[model samples]
Target: MSRAAVPRMLLRGWAIQVKDSSSFGFFIMSSLIEPVIFAAIAAYMFRAGNRPDALLYAAIGAGMLGVWIVTLIGSGQALTFLRHAGILELLIVAPVPFVLVLAPITLAAATVGMYSLAATLVWGWLLFDVPLGVEHPWLLLASVPATVIGLGMLGMLMASVFVLFRHANALTNMLGYPVWLASGFLVPVSLLPDWVRPVSWLLPTTWGAEAIRTSMIGGHPLPAIGACLGLAIGYFALAALTVRHFERLARQRASLALA
Candidate 1:
C-alpha cells in the first residue's frame, strides 16, 4: 500500500475492529467483565485474604487481570481465526504490512481492557463495598491507559509468535494465571519465590500493575508509567522483527493456512 493508503488502512481497520469486538457478546460479557464481578464478590467475601485493607488492591488487580486475559486471547487468536476463515493468505500477500493489519485488532482488544477496568471499579464499589480510595487519583487515572498501551504492544509480540503455532489458545491458557500471580496484580509479588521477582520485572504486567498499585498506595507512579510506555515501544520493535521472521517461516513451511 502507498504511504497515504497506510493511514486510511489503519483508521478504517481500527474502526472495523472496534465495531466487530463491540458486537461480540462473549467478548464483552464473559471474557471482559463477568468474571470480574464474581472475582470482586469473592475477594470481598474472603476479606481479600482476611485483610480488608487489601480489598481495593484486589479489586484493581481483578480489573487488570480482565485486561490481560482478553488481550491475550484476542490478539493471539486474530491470525488463527483469519487463517481458519481463509483470509490469512490475503493479509500476508497484501502490500500493507501484517502488523498494520493486526495492530488494530490487538489494540481494540486492549481497549476492551480499559472498559473492563472502569466497569470493574464501578461495580466493585456499588456491589461489593470495595474502596475506591486513591492517594494519587491523577496517577491512578493515568496508569489505566499506560497499562493498556503496554499490554497491547506486548500483545503484538505475542501475536507474532502465535502466528507460528496452531494451538495458540493453549498458550494463552498456560500464560494467564502464571502471569497474573507473578506480576503481583492481584497478589503481592513478595509472596512468590525470590527467583520470580527478576523474571517478573521483565514482564510488562509487573510494571503496569506496579504503576496502578503505586498510584493507589500513594507512591510515585511516574517512573512506573514511564517504564510501561518504554516497554511498549520496545515490544513494538521486537514485534516487527518477530512478525517478519515468523511470517516467513510459516509461509516457507506452508503452514500459514493449516489452521
Candidate 2:
C-alpha cells in the first residue's frame, strides 16, 4: 500500500469496526444500555442529596463511565480476537504494517464510547430533567474527540501489552471499576485520598474527564485538553515500541500463545 493509503486504511478499518461492534448485542448492552442504569442510580443518589447540579454532574460522569468501559473492554480483547481468528500472523507479514492494522481497532473502541456519552446525556435529560446547559460549547465539542483519541492511544498501549499475556481479560476485569474511580469519572479527584491522587494524574481518562467537565460546568478546559493530547503522543510512542517488541517475540515463538 502507498503511504497515502494508510490514513484511508485506518479510517476504513475504524468505520468497519464501529459498524461491526455496534451490531453486536453484548457491545450495545455493555457500552450503552447498562451505563444508563448507572447514570440513573447516580441521579437518584444525587437527587436524594438535593445538590443543585446533581443531575447534570451524574449524567456527565455516567457518560464518561460508559466511555471508559467500552474502550477498556474492546481494546483489551482486540489482539486476542485476532489471534483466535488466526489472522494475527497474516497481518504481521502484510506490507501495510501491523500497528496500523491494530490502531483502528483501538480507535474504534474509543469511538464507540461516544455513543455511550451521547446516550447517557440524552437519557439524563429526557428522564431526569437534567439541564443541558453548556459553559463552553466549542470546548465541549473539541474535548469529545480529544477524549476519544487520548483513550484510544491509551487503549493501543493496553492492547500491545495484552498481546504478551494469555489472561488479558483478568487484567481488564480488574481494571474497569478502579480506572473509572481513579479517573474521576463519577467523582472529583480532589475528593480521592491523597495517595491515590498521583495515580489519577497519570491516567488519560483523568484529563479527558476533567477537560470535559470543566468545559461543561464553568472553567478553562484547554489545559486538560492539552494534557489529553500530550498523553496521546506519549502513549502512541510507547505503544509503538511495545508492539515492536511483541512482534519480535512473536517472530521467535511463531505464536501468540504463552509458553
| TM-score winner | 2
Instruction: Please identify model 2 stretches exceeding 4 Å from their true place.
Output: 50-52, 257-259
Clashing pairs in 1: none
User: Against the unseen true structure, what C-alpha lDDT does each candidate score?
Assistant: 0.80, 0.87
The residue-level lDDT of candidate 2 at 86 comes to: 79
Model 2 clashing residue pairs (backbone): none
Clashes of each: 0, 0
Tens-digit per-residue lDDT, 1-259, candidate 1: 5788887887788778878877888678845566577566657666745776666676777877787888888787888867787888999988888888888778778877666667777877887687777889898889877887788889899998886776888998899889888888777889999999988877777888789878987788999999999999999999989988978888789887786
Candidate of highest lDDT: 2
C-alpha RMSD for every candidate: 2.3, 1.5
Q: How high is the lDDT of residue 257 in model 2? A: 46
The C-alpha TM-scores of every prediction are 0.89, 0.95
